[model samples]
Target: MIQLKTREEIELMYESAQLVSKTLGILAKEVRPGVTTLYLDKIAEEYIRDHGAVPGFLGLYDFPNTLCMSPNEQVVHGIPNHKPLKDGDIISIDCGALKNGFYGDQAFTFAVGTIDPEIDKMMRITRQSLYAGIKKCKVGNRIGDISFAIQLICENAGYGVVRELVGHGLGKEMHEDPQVPNYGRKGSGPKIEEGLVIAIEPMVNLGTYKVKFHNDGWTVTTRDNQPSCHFEHDVAVVNGEPKLLSTYKYINEALGITSNEEDEFLYNFMHD
Candidate 1:
């Protein structure tokens, strides 16, 4: 069944989103060459707990990390380890936080240093696909429309769209109702409604559309062993439009980059 949020519950969700935002902000500053993802995961756990929220991913279903740090060909759910990220490598960091009985989840694929043009293009376009998907999250639209928007953009670029994993609704629990897939036909699936919040993420690869899971049972990688990109945002439908609850501003600010990509979604929030 689909779960809807009340106005007051939405506020609580917003608070949870903010904690996730802050956690990503800190991770942004600490992501650099030679830094181990395991180290970053520890930092995230402490940061979330210090702020009164728990790390939503840790020990949830026996998973062992505060963050899902997938690097290079890894699609998602890659476990953090002592491996040091080298120059030209890209890693995807997906995080979740629980605050005030609500959950916030977000993900970002980042370059360790200067990367190849091909991988860079994959990252840029995959990130753009995330926005395309978000644009479809509005009142009266179906979840399939949002998925189609993402698939249309990413596939047109010759990138492989992962089919196994998916995004999902967010509320008191880390995973809620309505699985949000990255590939679907328009006009299919659940209808969008006000107070409906979801995490729209697109995991695109430079190779085939297939992926394989490691024997460790958590990490997932592209089947062809080529590079992949993943980007995400938590969005809420309000006033007949999609309102973004997660922002990459923290990442951009820390990296000294500037992009007005999210201005459309946060126009009123910026002014207020």
Candidate 2:
């Protein structure tokens, strides 16, 4: 069953989403060549708790971390460890928060330091695909509209869109209805509607779309051992349009980036 959130509920979820955004911003400043992902995980857990929201990923599925830190060829769900990040490596940080009976989930792939130009291009295309998907999340479109938009962008650029892992609807629970896949037909799947909130993530690999799940039961990596990029946003169908509850503004600000990529998706209520 699909759960449609009320405006008030969406607002509450917005608060949770912004906290995750802020948490990501805090970690952005520390994602240098020598920093460990576990260290960043601890910082996120503390910051989320200090802000009065629960760390949404901790113990949710017997998973033992506050963030999913996947680096280089790792696709997603990589566990945090003491291994220090190195220059030219990129890490995808996925985070969530639960506040006021709602949940917010978001992810971003960050460059550890100076990275390969090809890898940087892949990240840029993947992130752009995320917004392309978001643009299709409107009143009359089906879920496939969003999926197709993302797939077209990545595949045309000669990248692989991850097949097995998909984005999901989010509310009180981390995973809800309406599975949002990266690849699908143009006019298929569930119809997009008002009050429908989802986490639209595009996990693109530089090589084959096939992924290998690890024995640890959490880590996922590209089958061809090529770098992958993941970008996500929590979006809600509001007033017949898709409005973003999560923002990359904080992360961009922290990294000294000045892009208005998210301006089109800003929720109107937030400005009031």
Candidate 3:
């Protein structure tokens, strides 16, 4: 069953979501060549705890770290390690936080320093695909509508949409109902409605969509050993329109990036 959130519950979730967003923004400044993923994970845990929330990923499903750090060809769930990041490499950081009985989940693929132009293009397209899916999250639209919107954009750019993994509804529990796939028919799946909140993410690959699950039971990498990008946002339907519970504004500000890609999804409360 899809557990819809109440208006009060959604408000609480917004706080949780923004905490994750702020955490990502903090990490954005620290992500650079010579920094170890394990080091990044350490600070993230401390920050989340210092802010009065628990690290949602750590010890959840026995996962050891606060962040899932995937670099280069790795897709997601790559455990943080001691190896230092290098220039020209990209790393995807997926984070979660639990606050006030709610959970927030979001991810971003970051350039370690200067990266390959083709890889940068793939990252931009993947992030754009995330917005495309968010644009379809209005009341009465089917979950597949969001999926189709995401799929069309990436595939048209000659990128591969990951098939095995998916986005999902989120609230008190980390993973909720209504699995939101990245590839589906335009009108298929569950109808979106008010109170529906989901983490809409797109995992796009530079080569084939096929992925290899590592024996460690966590790491996932592109089968062809090519780079992949992942971007995510937390969105909720309010008064029949889609509102973003998560924002990249903090991250953009930290990086000195000025873009209004999320302006259309901004509801009034976000500004205050």
TM-score of each predicted structure versus truth: 0.97, 0.99, 0.98
C-alpha RMSD (angstroms) for model 3: 1.2
How much is 269 displaced in model 1, in angstroms? 7.6
Worst 10 residues of 2 by lDDT: 263-272
Across residues 153-249, which tens digit of lDDT does each residue of candidate 3 receive? 9999999999999999999899999899999999899999989999999999999999999999999999999999999999999988899999999
lDDT of each: 0.89, 0.95, 0.95
Worst 10 residues of 3 by lDDT: 263-272
Reference-based TM-score, model 2:
0.99
- lDDT (Cα) of model 3: 0.95
Per-model tally of clashing residue pairs: 0, 0, 0
Which parts of model 2 are misplaced by more than 4 Å?
270-272
TM-score of 3: 0.98
Q: Indicate the TM-score of model 1.
A: 0.97
lDDT of 3 at 256: 98
